[model samples]
Target: MKNKILIWGGSLLAFLLVVIVVLFIFRSRVLQYTIERVITKVENKYPADLNIGNAEFVDWNSVVLNDISFVPHGLDTLFTTDSVYATVSFRSIFKGRIVFKRLEVSDGYLTARKNGDVNNFDFLFKKSETAQPVDTTKGRNYGTLLNRVIETAFDNVPDQVDFKNLNASYKSPNRMIDVRMPFLRIDDGYVESQVSILADSIQNNLRVRGTIDPGDYNINASLYAFDEKGIRLPYVKKKFEGEVAFDTLHLSLTNKRYRNEKLTVRGRAMVNNLILNHAKLNDEDILVKESAIDYVVTLGQNLFEVDSATEVRVNSAKANIYAAYQNKPSKIYDLGVKTEWMPANDFFGSLPAGLFENLDGIKASGELKYKMKFHVNMDSLDYLVFNSDLDASKDFKIQQWGNTNLQKINGSFVHTVYEYGKPVRTFTVGPSNAFYAPINQISRHLRNAILTAEDAGYYSHKGFHEEAFRQAIIKNLEEGEFARGGSTISMQLVKNVFLSRKKTVARKVEEAIIVWMIENLDLVSKNRMFEVYLNIIEWGPDVYGAKDASRFYFGKEPSELNLNEAIFLTSIIPSPKRYRSSFDSYGNLRSHKGYYYRLIGGIMRRRGLITQEEFENLYPNVKLYGRARDLIVTAPDAAEEDTTEFELETIDLLDF
Candidate 1:
């Protein structure tokens, strides 16, 4: 029995050794056949030519490939490599998977260029061309989708990489970017890459290094300028029309967890010496010294949330932020931010330079804190909730003003009235300026009329009304357009007196900040702000202020307007340039304006701004006696004039 066992074992060993020897002798041919099969399959699907000059197995686990290239049909070369050497796992091949343990490339070039709308990379996304549009109404699990993508990406990346003399480029329209990488490597999950970039003829270099994890969500990376000029982004300027630069940017993803159909991700991102320049953001370049955010996000079945534990820091100020959006059943949103009470000096110093241009260099005393919350249900627009409050301690005070002096509205100053975003007139708000109307000199009917129509709570509230802003948001959402503004009497005053009239996000922000300062700090009194607002705003094409508007329409002074005349003047505030739409060929007010008169007059009467007899006697038979009378257009037919009235009623009556 012993002899039989020994003979059988020797026979099995001899057979296995012979099989190994045969495979080694034909390894090059086997590798070549495998490469050919892969090339044929890829070419069949992509409509491209894939070629390899030579392929062979240098060792049991290593493959050497030379002169590899790929090109789409009738297009420039997409990729080319002089040589590639990869160490692959042989056992994974038996399981129908090719895993590369190490990969090295020599002299590689990849190009992605776009001319107009046509691009060479479209072929790589060929499958997407034939794909159907997504049905957004359908239910989806956000966690499941994101997890699958992360798993697929992490599973495929090689553990080690060594690439030298690699070049890549992209061009679109008049813009182009060229990247030259001298060295790129990954070893034991550590990555290092130094790349020189030329974008739109501007040159820069960048350095990147990080500790990465493939099987887990663990990464810490730092990216910054290779030289002393800081890191300027390559593709952002053209894409966003904004120049962005930073000294250093770091990101760390420390943890990921899943439970109860929710995937939680914890991470932190940091930046130093960040600069942003854009028209919509600000007219000047905004600079921040340091900023960071430690965030925890929960991606759920159909919702995404950044938990309240998330902390954000900018310079010396810090805040806790929470935001969420739910798409299931109906779209709902929520956002909140709460900040710690910090020194007012630090708060003012932390303001971004260009974003808060009016507040820059402002000096203050005491402590300040801020809190805000917003909630909305798209399906129920009326139920939207919002509140924002920025409070200072009792000892808080502004010691010095910044670039803009908030107290200027209290007295005479150069007020520029803009027409179509160009300065049509620059004059003083006091008696020295032509057609300037003081609060007391303006007609009581006109004052009451403008205030009641533009902002009913202009006297009782601060510079901003939370309810008004909330309703503004709801109204805009219902109309699916920006058709309303929540500007108060004070906001309107600040916008006209201290800020440019250009419609931009940055201007709006500056206007808001200035309004708060003047109104809350009593830098400008309510009556004075209202006086300046009435004097500087445009009431018609080239007709500005209450004094000019009255003269232009009725050939009368500011104090001579009656109730009907004031109401008529107020109604045109929405489309002042199109004010002729409300008049007939004879310069008589449109008939539908009677409804507007009754609506505004009744409100004034109820609020005790006018008597009941004044409200009851109100009429829309306003007549023009000035140059505006000759500007009215002749009606094609008197019987069809009601169509014009109907069309005119579609506009929302406003004064600011």
Candidate 2:
């Protein structure tokens, strides 16, 4: 019995040893085959690279694979990873399934770059021939191995991917990067974004939040657009920067059969502190220095259809804009835009012959609203209507206003026009008799008195006039109103040339600074400055400038005015409408003749421009051409002389 048992035990041991050796010999080949199957499955479903070193089954239930790695080409450079590592379980080896318990990756880097219309990773999958062929002769069913491997590999991945200490960077040419947020992720068609990116060149900050589906070609991102650039285009330069955040971004390609199939996307986003600098679009480059601007904006969009509602938002430190349906070539659709305060002077402040040349400085702020309807096929616009109101205030010392030195003026104009590619018609109306000269001609005796207080050396002095300003300030304090302005003639000219009608301490300071700059300019430029100021100064009513007002009111040129007419024109300079009121009523001027006499006396005492004799002759009988009418009455003749008939009768009797 002992001998028989030994033989049986020995035989069992031999059988077990054979089984163990066979398993050990096939382990490495089996492991290698399993990895290759996984690679083949990945290649079929998506584009990827999978490579493996020798793999070995360490024990019956565990596998160790060396140098197992994947490199997916065509992914954005922002999502590049150096290598991946994981330990997989072999318990399901007989069942033809892979179960990975742990996965880890290292040396991952991300970056984004914008170059015109092309973005990175757009060229991926261009070379499909580079893909490797799958080996189908492995373990498990030969025909089903590829599909199962693919299913297993994709199934084990988490819906949300986690990365450890990721870093990202981005760049664009010619634009200062205002804000940048590098770390980002997407899972289940939703993107997890934590980035703050800005660019000074574009003058805006984007707070991006949303989901992006790379496979379906849909993206949902939000942006905040602001315009603090403070300048106009062609020569303006400004910078800005800020942060942005987003929520619930979603996008998908809709296959609905209704109206052309489209890609729809939606999301919400917010932005803060966007910086802008040196923002300009030029038909021809205008050489100028640039400034920096900062501001913020927030907006949201829902159910955006790419085919129906293609929209683009451009925000930079200098400007903000939103445009939609811009790609349609045959029709003009819905479009909207909003722009912040920008001044012509601020934009062209440094240009030699541009908008800044002849002005003191500019104080400009307003809104422009318009609707444009057109036919894209004909490249023709139908009707563009807009409403804009602007007020320009000018003050001049040495500048002429109908033969009088213009002190200051507040002028406003409202314009509305309809255009079919070109202006069809326009209508404008404003304060009648607002012109200075007509009123001045009626109050001529007061001309010398007003001129005595004006600065004769205004053209030679810089912006500051210590004596004049001090006297004007004292006069203003005494009057309880802005009765006097202290600006120099050059300063006044500057203010009138470029600025708006806003009266403020800051505007005054800016005017002073710009006028000071004018003194250092050349003689020709100084004269040109004077010319621009004279031409733009508001005289009265709808009238502007000496030449225009002289022609309209007196039927004479500015140089043709006599002392009486010139002084009268000057008298109305302060308040043309008041003079017009006086002219309209005879009693008003008759009662005020004493005041006019006193004004003449003051003009004489001040070394008045006209002689004392000339002043006396003109003061009392200032002939206003159309005041009253002269009438002559005539009676019908009753009796007529009869000398011819009596002489004829006496002569006839003598002749017979």
Candidate 3:
């Protein structure tokens, strides 16, 4: 009986060993069929083609896929990977969940292309409109849909994900971007991505490691972006290239829809070795060795708030800046900038290159201290304010101006006009000085008419007409051109004698500096300044100055000019080069002259320069008897320019 039992047990053991061997031999084929069925079920919804070279289970907790490629149903291949390994939790699987402990992807390639608003990867899922307004009445439906999504996604998500050696390329019509990532890891709500990017002529390395809680719509991220080669910026359609390095940038975002329907952002950023160069500005370098900023932002539907404090070190000079912007009920921006005592050259050197090209030989001697406060509102400029204080210890000398120097310069004035002698020589070598006149030699009617028509606040204000300047700026902003200029007499004189005719912000700034110097230094008395202005002012094609203008228009002396004649002269000062358009083909004044005569005459009478009887008698009935003789008053120190006879001098309103 014992022998028979031993033989039966041996037979049973042999049968069990054969069953285990057969299962081991077919394990790969079982895994393959199982994955193929899973992919087929996924394709029912997402519609994607999945290719897999091999799949195998390592023990019961881990699975590995080799040579996997994913292609959208009717599209080209989107991604390819050498291997993907996933470790699943057995307990979760028993509970109808496919929870993963770790999932790693290696040696992957991804290609994405965008054409207009549609992109290549868009084929993976059903398409929908990009933007759609939310209806609160249907908010419960969204919750239902979200719950359904979570039930489905809970079985497919991995708790931890990792990728290595990924190459991605994205292309569009205007630009192409390429990215290479050596490592990317994500666990729970935490994510870390590091990439080296090269686009056009720019190359940079970026790392963003952060936690994103989608359930609460919150983000806390730290950024590290650096580039050895500078990036190009076109802020105002002007290209400026700058090298950028940010050692630390911590950002936190919070959503408060329950309280205010707003998103709040807080951040601290630090930068080093930032140098900028502009080609239009003659390739001058603006260097900022270091900068540190603390900023906060709050954004809503139609309103936003920004507050920032920055410390900047530029061109070896240090400055502290505080800026705030609010757009709730009304838009407002306020900025306060202060700088310690620094060399004047350092300040000037920091400006755009070629702005002071006309004064290359000039040297400024002194330390400069500056403080500025700026505020502006979008609705109206009634609240617009800009106050600045700049002081220098010594004078600035310029060799090319022959004897022009700036001493005890202060910050004041809205606009200035000047001819830089080289490109625009109308004030230097033209017939502008052919008939000079002193303030006493000129008639009071002409002076008062000019002051009334051009600058009513000429004597009251130091050198700026704040209200007029504000209006001029408003008009320009609305008209989108340099259409109006509320220049004071002193401002116009400085522009005529000292600056160029270019319509640029840089030129305007230089003109203001010169006007401030001229006013503060008392270099020229107000009366003499007006005299020089009248002499250099262009009257007609070849007519200039009060003497020649009186002779050219009425064949009279500056003192002998009548009320009507003086009114006519002052009316054309705004556009002297185009004043001939004011006359008809018969040499008689047009209907517009009647309007000007009434306006100028009324103002003149109000200022006591003309009596009521004279104002009433003044009419636009001036007769052009003959043309003025050809006369050129060239300054001995000025270079002569060859110009035509009928080429009127371009004398525009000194725009700021």
Candidate 4:
């Protein structure tokens, strides 16, 4: 009885051993057949040709595949190659969970071509108007179908997987060249990276560390993407570090009912020692140290939105620039911007030529603030508008004689107020000399007269005054002539600061907007506003600002003009060209218009700005001296026109 039982047990053990040997012996064929079956299913759905070589199965626990290649069925080009080896561990074989291990790829290549709007991978998957229903039926028959579907889905996925070592190259023709790193792993719907890339002729080296959730279609990479362009997108390269770091990049794709929605890019960049040549008023090179930039952008449904900020710190200077944008077909909205310049003089001197040439060597150290809001509409040329404000400091000075010299200049004005579609007004208050007379006494007198007539309240208003503008407008309309402008001193200052001398409603509107902006800004003080106005305001032909005017006319300090001299200077404000010239020693008009004196006297009296006695004292016939011929009365010539014949012709025509 014992021998019989032993024999039965031995037989059973032998049978089990034989079964294991047979399974091992045919393992390679079994794996090959299984892989071929999966490939066939994938081909049916996506039309792809797959090549498999030297597949082996191990103890019914795992399978190894070597030398695999895949190509689109209709396309003759190979898309990928897998060499060395791979093992599919059968830990969850019944459930079709493929855990790959020890994969190696060699001399693999991927090529993609895109032209116009056609992408090479557009046909990678089976075309379907709607997603197919999932098969939930059980039993071997239904199980086969489900397994085939899952295998087909995995085969159609776009991936380059390799372990151990991999050498891969990609050519896109229309896209950029790419060379990828070795060692790839995929498990549990997760693709973890141990990868690097050499792109653009291998001139750029990119290091990438990230994770991709294939099931969720999301990717995040911490990248160091750079080239030798000396120009970088989003961030600039700086010294100490030759490359900029685009840190913590993230991207995600989500499929909705109608479209595949994409959310792209969340990251920041760090660049050290960014150098900008000739960026300041004096054409000096600037170095931004440890500059950092942060940004986020999203694109979907043909719309793109971006928000970014930059912080730069240089030698004794620091600046912060913030910007945001929403791109749309009808309009571009400039959400907002705020730029703060600390120790502004350091950068001010580096501005380009023709921008602030006369301001060179000015030791102006103060905060400069700028704020603007506006929109541009592509549908209509007239649909444009913006409002801006600029403010600075009055304590700024000109560097001369190796020392910082303060002009005792304290003043302020509104820089801009209207743009696009808004009504605007502006005002200013500064030293009389800064605005009207920076040159010599004669030039100062001429400047004063011109400014007073064109924009009064130049020395009193705080950058804007609606009431004054209203009164001036009404007065001009009542006179049936556009002889007077209602702009304040700040408005005129703004015009001088940003534009040339062109008399037009558009120019006026722009000027008013700028002035209003300056008035509302906190970066610039009232006094600083005044200083800039004085430095830029035109005094006369070839004369600008109080300093130049003072040098040209009185040959004295801007502060030296007496009250009578000031009044005389102010009187010529309306027509400097008619009044600016040497006259006879005698009070009689010489080389100038007698009408100018009468006109000034009349205006002063009508405005209640002068006494009757003072008006009478300025009459043309106050005194007489010098040779009669040399002192012969010469009517003031028009500054803009010169022609004795034209005058005679006019007289003749009038007589006729």
lDDT: which candidate is best? 1
lDDT order of candidates, best first? 1, 3, 4, 2
Q: Write the per-residue lDDT of candidate 4 for residues 80-175, one digit (tens) a residue.
A: 555544556544343334445445455566666555654445465333446664333321232233333433454444443544444454445534
Candidate number with the higher lDDT (1 or 4): 1
Q: Is candidate 2 or candidate 3 better by TM-score?
A: 3
Pick by lDDT: 2 or 3, better one: 3
Point out the higher-scoring one by lDDT: 3 or 4: 3
List clash counts for every candidate, in order.
Answer: 0, 47, 6, 65
TM-score of each model, paired residue for residue: 0.76, 0.34, 0.61, 0.49
Poorest lDDT segment (10 consecutive residues) of candidate 4: 644-653
> Candidate 2 on 1-656: residue-level lDDT in tens?
99999999999999978866765576555566667788898766555565555555545655545454444565434355554444455454444455544444444555656677655533332324565553333222211332233234334444344344444555557543433334444456555544444444333323345554443343455433223332122113332222222222223322112122222233322222222222122112223222222212111121121221232222221333333333233333332333343343332232222222234233323322212221122133223222212222232122212211122223333322222223332222123423323222332333233334334454565545755664564566467678888665577666554443356443564465455434632323534444444444444554556655465445565556555455455556556445454332221223344355445444454454555456445542222332110000111331221121111011111221
Model 1: how far is 355 from its true place, Å?
2.6
> After superposition on all CA atoms, how large is the RMSD of candidate 2?
23.8
Candidate 2 TM-score over all chains jointly: 0.34
Minimum summed lDDT over a 10-residue window in model 1 is located at 644-653
Q: After superposition, how far is residue 22 of candidate 3 from its true place, in Å?
A: 20
